[model samples]
Each structure stands twice: as structure tokens, then as C-alpha cells.
Target: MPKKDNFDEARLAEAIKIALAQKKPNIAKIAREFDVSRTTLSDRVKKAITPTTPTESRRNALTSYQERALVAWIHQMCNWNLPPTRQDRQVGKNWAYSFMARIPAHINLAPVKQKTKELRRI
Candidate 1:
């Protein structure tokens, strides 16, 4: 199981800034002042660990551009009545579904048809 981060990223960034601004930086003091983890602040100040935003995934096999391209390809294949084969996809089995969930407006694998205006009268 992964440990949840109790500290806010913004607070950590602020702490790193304060620590770096000082002539003789006290990581522990800055961390305590900003309510961030001492070790994390120290690591960031020392450039020991690279900072990553919340949306950045370390284990992603494809970039966002690549994912969008794959979605476009899937849409194109469906339009041509030639659904992609399993061997055609290089991504994991769940990647397509997950990608759709992430950005539903971009591509919908299965869109339901709405009733016509005449059908509403019945």
C-alpha cells in the first residue's frame, strides 16, 4: 500500500523557497514554519528529488499527446467499420477505457442515440 501525503505541495514549495533564500538555510526550521516535512523540504532544496505536479504520473507508458493520437486512431477505425484488433494496440487492456474516463469530451467509444422529436409525442 502507498502512503498518502499529508503535506500540501504548495506549502512544501513555499518552505523550499524560504530555506533557499536564507544565508545559512535551516531546513528543519523552515519546514516547521511552513508545516511541511523536513526531509522533503531538505531534499527539494538540495535538488536530491525532482518536483512533480499532481497530474504527472511516473509510470505512464504514453504521453498525453500519444494518448490523444491513440483515441483519434480508435475513432477513425470505428468510423471506417474496421475496429482495431487487440494486436493493433500497444497499450494495456484498460488504457482505452481509462483514457475515455479521463477526457470524455474528446472521444466516446459508445455514444447512445437520443430519441427523435416525433418519438417524444408517444
Candidate 2:
């Protein structure tokens, strides 16, 4: 049997962008239009999109101002109580860090680690 459709960050983002551009961030509308469940569509859109450590290095990247804005926006939009520290901003730009925090915690909001060997491999 074919594996179930696992929505990717890119697709979710596209859907969100399309919805927003159309002046409709409505979960139900987007879900129905996209033929995806409302919960799944919401989860995908809310999930952070970042690159792994090595990918970050390979990209010769630095924490851009835009990235910081994204972190701030994510905090506000998600109602994350965590402060936007410099370290948090830096780590939030990385996929591993974002992905780690994406794992549902009790609070649904927490500052992810800024550094990790395993994350570098990811």
C-alpha cells in the first residue's frame, strides 16, 4: 500500500500564502479547498521551516533580520511566551532546532536548543 500523505513544510507554506493572498486564512476553507483535513493543514502551516546545521554551514548563512522577524512573528502568532533572545533567534533559523521544538511539548511553547552535534548532522 502507498504511504499516507505527509504534508511538507513547503506545501503547507504555499497553501498558507495562497490563502493569505486570497484574503482567506480560514482553516476550514483552506482544508476543504486543498482536500486536506483542517487539523493537518493547520499543523503544517504552523510548523517552522528551517535548515539543518550542515545545511546552514553549506549555505554560508547568518541570522538575517528577516529570520529574526519570522521568529518574532512565530512567537506572536503561536502565542509562545518565550522571549526572543539572540540565541533563540539564531537557533530558530536552523531546521534542527525548529524541528526539535516542533515536537509537541506540554506547554506547546518553548525555546529550542541553539547547539547540538546531532542537529549538525541533520
Candidate 3:
């Protein structure tokens, strides 16, 4: 079966830009314009598209700002007496470190299951 996400990845911002420039944005119409699912377009907008695809380099690993934010969030959770479970820590580490290097540009969210699958292959 063909991959569900087979379209060009580099043009997502363009599509999003086109969608938002409308005076009265319509998700369905924007999706048709970009040849992507409406839900996909909606998600990108909601995320503000900070995080993007993953890569293999480590130079841009985690910026100091991002690291501090993550660590602070983790510590905050602890202060709340609602410490994250093992899985949450794993996710945090995976994202905070260079494992997310492969992600596309400006994408803040990580696909945990997909990362797990990649880890297994490595």
C-alpha cells in the first residue's frame, strides 16, 4: 500500500500560508487546494507548525531554550506531585535529545510510535 502521507513535505508552510490568507478560511477548501486532508491542515495550524520532520544530524539537536523549557516542564510536573510515568520520561528524553534531529523543520510534536519503530530498526 502507498504511504498515506505521500505528498511533498517541504511545501506544508506554503499550503498553510495559503489557507490562512483567506478572509474567511474554510478548512475543506484549503485542504483541496493543498491536496491534503482537512484534518492535517487543521492540526498544523493548531500546532503553529513549530516542529517538522526528523533528521539524522545532531548539530541543531536541542536549542538551549528548548532544553530549558523541557526541563522546567518536567520539574514543574514533579513539584505538582504528579510526576510523569516512565513512558512520559522516555518521551521527554526522546524529544529533548538529538533523537528528534530527523524531524522536519518547525514541527514541535513527535510521533512516539514512529520513533519507537525507527529505534527498533537501528
Candidate 4:
């Protein structure tokens, strides 16, 4: 595997400043000097004064503790010489749906409809 390169904007900024002061801010030359692509240097220049916030993403249905509790329940059930059957699995899934619903909607969960579809497919 090739070595991973980390962006060092602070170091690049220092080099760019010197080039700018000399009235010779060449993207290709700066990129070559910095051992990076010209596109990377151009992208740095394109960025605004203010750093942007990271994009938001969907979250899990349950918190770590809650998820662990559910997993533990399943494990206990299996160890008790009683693995859940199809119906039992459906019940467990329904219980999970209800559990997810009791929490904030921002806590994303797989819809119950998804489970229903899988059941039908099976």
C-alpha cells in the first residue's frame, strides 16, 4: 500500500506567503515544492476564511448501552437452550421497533416495514 499523505495547511500557508511576498505565487511550482498536487494547492486557495462544519449523517436507533442490553438478552436466550424461532424473531424485532420509537426520532432506526419485507421474502 502507498503511504497516506496528511494535509498540512499551516505549513503550506507559510510557503505560499513567501511566494506571494515575492510576487510569484505559482500553483504548479508551489505544488512541486510542497510535494503535492497542484489541484490540492488550488483547493486550499478556494476554501473560505472560515472553516466549514462537517456534514451531518444519520445516527443509530439505540445508544451503546441499550444496544448491548438487547444483544445480551439474545445471547442469554440462546445459552438457555432456547434459540428464538421465526415468530420469536419477529417478536424480538417488534420489541426493537417499539424500543427505538420510545427514543427521539433523531435516533434513526430500521423501519418495522423493513422487517416485514424480510419476513415475506423468507
TM-score against truth, every candidate: 0.45, 0.27, 0.35, 0.31
Index of the highest-lDDT prediction: 1
Candidate 1 lDDT over 12-64, as tens digits, reads: 87787777778789888887898777777777887833565568664666777
Please tell me which predicted candidate would have the highest TM-score against the true structure.
1
For all candidates, the clash counts are 0, 2, 17, 0
- Candidate order by lDDT, highest to lowest? 1, 3, 4, 2
Q: Kindly provide the TM-score of model 3 when superposed on the true structure, using C-alpha atoms.
A: 0.35
Tell me the deviation in Å of residue 119 in model 2: 44
Residue 76 of model 4, lDDT score? 62
The lDDT for every candidate, in the order shown, is: 0.71, 0.54, 0.59, 0.56
Tens-place lDDT per residue, model 2, 25-69, is: 687877667665677666655553333344333342335455555
Report the lDDT tens digits of candidate 3 across residue range 10-52: 4566778876677567878777777776777777776664667
Cα lDDT of candidate 3 equals 0.59
Our tally of clashes for model 3 stands at 17
Ranking by TM-score: 1, 3, 4, 2
